[model samples]
Target: MSFKITIQPSGHTFPAAADDSILEGALAHGLLLPYSCRNGACGVCKGRILAGNVDYGEYQDTTLTHAEKAAGMALFCCAKPLSDLVIESHEVSRAQEIPVKMLPCRVEKMQKVADDVMVLWLKLPANERLQFLAGQYIDILQKDDKPRSFSLANAPHDDGLLELHVRHIPGGTFTEQVFTRMRERDILRIKGPLGTFFLREDNDRPIIFVASGTGFAPVKAIIEHALKIGFQREMHFYWGVRKVSDLYMLDKIGEWEKLGIRFTPVVSDEAWHGRTGFVHDAVLQDFSDLSAYAVYACGAPVMVQAAHRDFSAQRGLQDDAFFSDMFTFAPKQ
Candidate 1:
């Protein structure tokens, strides 16, 4: 009960099961299609049904007007193929092709994984989708002052819902509210795909990812994306936390380990059963010469700075081989 869906221009094809939306099928096969909300209520997945029979699932009338339907446009998020289909849709292949958008989102769900870590699932409006690279972040537009930035913890291949990891900044307005007052469905504004932090797929060097605290957010996205695209280089992930309890998402990390990515956990505070000391120190101790390695490090400003400085100075890593993200202070070098 699977149908082949062909995307135009790019001419890429993937299988869509009888119960699968064209968008879901494409993403499951590593095809990047532009979509915001998986629900048919949004028209972001709208594309011309060039040649196919489909059961267009329920969606608001205005979302797919009769005129548009006659014109062959269907919501890929809601349409299930009745037969093999040919579709005319733009595929997202480059960051520059994605338009930065300012959209309102609702807090769909929240989980307090650690004492100070909160995981938020955001739902965009029905008609909007924010196309972003795997390791980018979003700015939550607040009432006044600057927008609070948070890394998108979810990989692009799993973009049905936007996931963010927020560390509770004590006494901080937004975080305090997020921990104490924000409820499911609470509204917020966001602008993103904002930073240049992402995978450089052009190279063939071994990859070393260093993450600390919530900085694990972006690193998680990059690693997940790499896995989805079939990682072509050796990958070593080093996650450093103050205590073992601060480490969450071990199950996902375990899956990555099974996929051949090495995992190293470093604890800086309290006694631990694993490697001890700063996360970067763990990398330094292991990789004395990293001239051919690509490093993607994210975390506290000090850790990012230290990993960049030492890995290049001592390990012989090329200046262009390091990439880091935090407020987009500087370019990758």
Candidate 2:
């Protein structure tokens, strides 16, 4: 049976079926309730059940102590409704609302998709999952060196294995190890679900995604999430690379095109028989005005800067309408 669930203060209400976790129901309604480790290992999703009964599904005893339970608290991640409910919980409307986590993960698999790009799949420990929005990144921790940040390529819905596309850089320490020595079952520490470079879902504005090199990682995440949620906004995706060989995931791109999302692959430096030159300029060439589009740009710092300057000043895109994440490379040592 389905029951009505109401949020205190906000007074927002949504329907929750008997089998759906409180978090699941809220998310299905586009109501962002704070959550982490949706498996109930983390207490980040704990909140007061101000009214009505709940199943309070399986969870670690320590995460939801008897004292807290008696005080009307329940772990929303594991709790399922028994009747209509009113819950006292804050919504996660901003990136900062999600908790950051540091956890150990195993390299479950690795595939070299291109000459310089290696896709790594990381598996979190049992009962632990990192909660994050699409397009966020994680920092791979190192014992004797600084952490290396990589964008999560998989959307939140398909987060069983954290996907990361790591590009090899000449003289780079970590990437050199990844390309030369890292193997499956290798243990690694990661901290995140970080960054603000995510989709702004509040509006119905058409989106123009500009990605370069491995910047395609985060853009892939956002686009996948958008598609999963059946976002009806018009989307145009342009991916740029140094050469034709630098472009990977053509099969997946082909699938997305069939679903109505426009895809343009731009190759700079060396070209075949497709779009060439700077990726941003291709957008300029296609659209006479971008005043109504929301542009999300990622990749090299120079390309991001150029897109930001030209799109707003030349193409009439509003300054606030453009969002970007500049991929900075490690310095050669």
Candidate 3:
């Protein structure tokens, strides 16, 4: 059985299946409810049950008090609709709306997807969760040196483990540790859900995402989130690498391709059968007008700069329709 849920103020409504938590249903329908630690250990998802009933699944007592429960407040992350429901929650529509957190996370898993690229999965405390926009990034805090920033590769719905793609920069101490000394269960500090590079869902315009090298991280997050919300707009992804070996995650990209998204891998240094030259050039060669589309580009500063300049000045793309995150290497220590 499923129940109809209505949100106050916004007046948005969606169906919550019997097995679905209120948060799950809301997110599945593209409703951005403010929540963290989907396990109910945090009170961030607490809201008033304006009408109807919910199962109010398992939760920490301190997070949701008995009096609050008696007063019709429940954690949306843990609550299951028992009947048609009316709830009160202000949706999160901006990056500033989500809180920034500084917490300890363990390096739960790591994989070398390429000769120079290592994928790290950081696990937070069982009692905590980090809420973030899909394309935002986090700072990996360090003890002696400055923090290292990496775009989050996982979408918000898959937040059990924070994902980061690290490129081993020669002479950079922290990345060297990731390639050499960083081990499973090693603790690391992080502060974020930062940056304003998330997708804008208000308009129904098509999208073009440009990524270079490891810049594919945040683009992967945005695309996955877009797919999860059932976003129907046409999407084309262009990934640029120096060589065939530099391109990773083709399996995931293949899945996206099957879902009607267009994927183009551009090789710069050595070429076999794909488009060559700069990544942005491939985009330029395809589209002549971008006035009605939104472009999200992430990569090195030079590529981002060139794309922004060319896309707007030549292709008639509006300044506001362009969004980007430039990946700059940390200073060598």
Candidate 4:
């Protein structure tokens, strides 16, 4: 049977199915509740069950002590509602709300999403999860002198496994391995949830997201997160690639279009049926004034710089409204 749950203070409420933990139900309904390990090991998800009964599922002894439990506290990540519940908890509204972590993960899956892009899924050890704000990049720690960094391509609410989009750069050893020899079950060390390019949720302005080549990685993360939270702000996403082949993940973008997200795929190197020329130019051609909008751009430095410069100077967008992350080549091994 399904039960209802109400979060205190915010007064946000959602229905929870019998098999779903409180956290799962909340996330599925676009609620960004504060959580970490998802498994009950981390007390970050602990909160008072102000009213109603719950099946506090499996948890670590030290995490939810008897005293805390006796006081009606429960780990939302593992707790299943036994009846309608009123919970005292708050949403995570900032990047600092979650802790960064250094973890080793096994390459669980990989897909050649584009001619030069490999989408990888990294699985943490059992009961382990990495909490991160959307749009953050992670440094892949290798034995090489310098580590490589890649933006996470998955949304925070769906963080069972970490996802990254890696571009195959010629002469880049790590990327070369990823394209050529990296195998499933390979272990990789990562330091992350780094960078400050996440979506600014507090603002109510419409959003324009620009992505070039592989820079779409972080933008994908941010867009998915924004969509999951049920944000209704006007969203215009422009992803520019050299050729049609370079534009991967169209399926995901197409899904967004169904939800009213304006999607413009700009192809620079080839003639296409869709919009053409520089991605930023497409934005300029469409929107005469951007001052009222927030623009997040990622990918090649050239594109990010161009978007930052033009969107502010020509389109009247505020400098602060233009957020960007430039993809730079990692130091060679």
Candidate 5:
């Protein structure tokens, strides 16, 4: 048995199987719902249950509180529909456009970009080329079947090889293997071309790119692709880190500066001599009027959330003009 699902605001309709979560059903049918942490950790997939009954499985209270549930909000990622339903959501438009795939990739090269960051270049099977937007990510399937997602650091034109910037997290299941046991020519399974964080090249608006830590990975791909395609829009990059050593690819930024791309390196710890403050603050200090610009942010959830709030409220940026990808650390079991 299956239930029909309708999403309002966009009026997109799809089908949900009896045993599947609404999100899983939608995704299976190539619909792209706004979601992160499909395990129900993040609240990004929360939506109103307008017209049907649902049974929610295990989920974090921080994502959907009892009060919110009583008020009709449901986390579609974990909510299994008990009957045909209507839902109100804003992010259902792009759900059908992005394609996801799983393929085998061989490690081509690995370079240490920072003290704790390594850039891995993986060559995809020549017969199975991946077609993904510049700012999207791929997930490495691990032993326990857990997946670790990483943004593609190289632009599409690079072809054949996918680049990823991975930060070594102490005791992290995936990072441990990446730093210790992973090797060249080793085969790894990856599923991708996920997320909707790509650049919308349709608009000629100026761009503000903000990144923290390895968050710079996708932003780097977007910028390189933009340059490759001869996009004339003005772009300003603000990258934040704790210390000078953390700014691993500073030299690359310098090279980009020579090409007329505005680069600002911000540091929070006082042990440095350059810009000392939050990265978003540096952007605000330089460009007070953001109403005419589009902002792309990637990094810690705290930084992305903070930038989304402040840029929209204080900097005159339209709410829709801000796009972000929040990288969260897996909770220790």
Candidate 6:
């Protein structure tokens, strides 16, 4: 049996099956509610349960505190509606317009960009075209039906191809396959255009793009899309890495710098000759006032969390002005 779920403010309604999470149902029907880390680790999917009962499955309490539950808040990522429901959330404008599809993609190329990072380019079916914003991601369907998500490194304008930066995780089920068993022309099933971390072209605020390691993938997409659209707002990109070699696409960024985009490379590990500090610190040092700036941060959970806390609390950036995607790894057995 399925239940009717209605969203406030926008009044968007969709069907939610008993076996599916709210987010799963909403996305299955092409309804876009703001979300990230659909596993309920990130609070991006938190929303108020205006009416109806929901059974929230296994989720981090930190993402949904008891107090939040008492206040009628639930993580839509894991919430299963038990009855007709009404929710309060800000609908993602672009996400609502884009059609999400499941398509067969063939591995076209896999080039190692760094010691551990490989740039995987997949070719979409010739007859099926994918239209996704710069910072969105796709989920690779696995044997047991488990899906692993990776952000697209290239903008939609790139055409008929999807680029993803895959970092080799020692025993990662998917990454290991991509590096060893996976080959060119191998077909894989993918579903996508997920996540709400796209470019906010409507806002004229200056942008602060922060990335660490392969996290630069999506940030690169956002910047490239911005440039392609002729965005005049000032853009500053800060990339943090342990050593010079870690900045794999340094030359590409250098080319972008010549086009008038401000680029800063930061190294956190000591024994570095260049800027030695956190990437966000570099931003703070340069701009004491960020009241009018919007920050887009992606990378390790630690870096993304730190930037959100520091930027909002100390640097005068408004809460909504700071957007982030915290890349996480599944627990080891």
Ranking by lDDT: 3, 2, 4, 1, 6, 5
For TM-score, candidate 1 versus 5, the one ahead is 1
Cα misplacement distance, residue 170 of candidate 1 (Å)? 2.7
Number of backbone collisions per candidate: 3, 0, 0, 0, 3, 0
For model 6, the run of ten residues with the poorest summed lDDT: 324-333
Q: Candidate 1, TM-score vs. the true structure?
A: 0.84
Report the C-alpha lDDT of model 1 over 174-254, residue by residue, as the tens digit.
Answer: 889999999999999998777788887778999999998998999999889888877689999999999999999999999
List candidate 4 segments past 4 Å from native. 331-333
- Residues 1-333, candidate 3: write the lDDT tens digits: 989999998999999998999999998777889987889887999999999999999999999999999998999999999999999988999999999999999999999999999999999998788888899999988887598999999998888899999999998889999999999999999999899999999978899999999999999999999999889899999999999999999999999999999999999999588899999999999999989989999989899999999999889889999999999976212
What stretches of model 2 exceed 4 Å from their correct place? 1-6, 11-18, 28-30, 50-53, 65-71, 82-86, 331-333
lDDT tens digits by residue: candidate 2, 193-293? 78899989887789999999999999999899888767889999999999999999999999999998899999999958999999999999999999999
Which stretches of model 1 miss by more than 4 angstroms?
37-74, 83-86, 126-128, 201-203, 327-333
lDDT of each: 0.86, 0.90, 0.93, 0.88, 0.83, 0.83
Deviation from native of the Cα of residue 249 in model 1, angstroms = 2.1
Total clashing pairs in model 5 = 3
Cα deviation at 86, candidate 1, in Å, is: 4.4
Cα misplacement distance, residue 327 of candidate 6 (Å): 0.8
- TM-score of model 6 relative to the true fold? 0.70
**Per-residue lDDT of 277 in model 1:** 91
Residue 320, candidate 5: how far off, in angstroms?
1.2
Question: Residues 115-182, candidate 4, lDDT per residue (tens digit)?
Answer: 89999999998877777878988899889658798989898888888999999999998999999999
Expressed as tens digits, the lDDT of each residue in 30-104 for candidate 5 is 455776556677677789999989998889888799999999999887899999999987653342454577888
- The whole-model C-alpha lDDT of candidate 5 against the native structure comes to 0.83
Error of 1 at 171 (Å): 2.9
The CA lDDT at 323 in model 6 is: 85
Q: Which stretches of candidate 3 lie over 4 Å from their true place?
A: 331-333
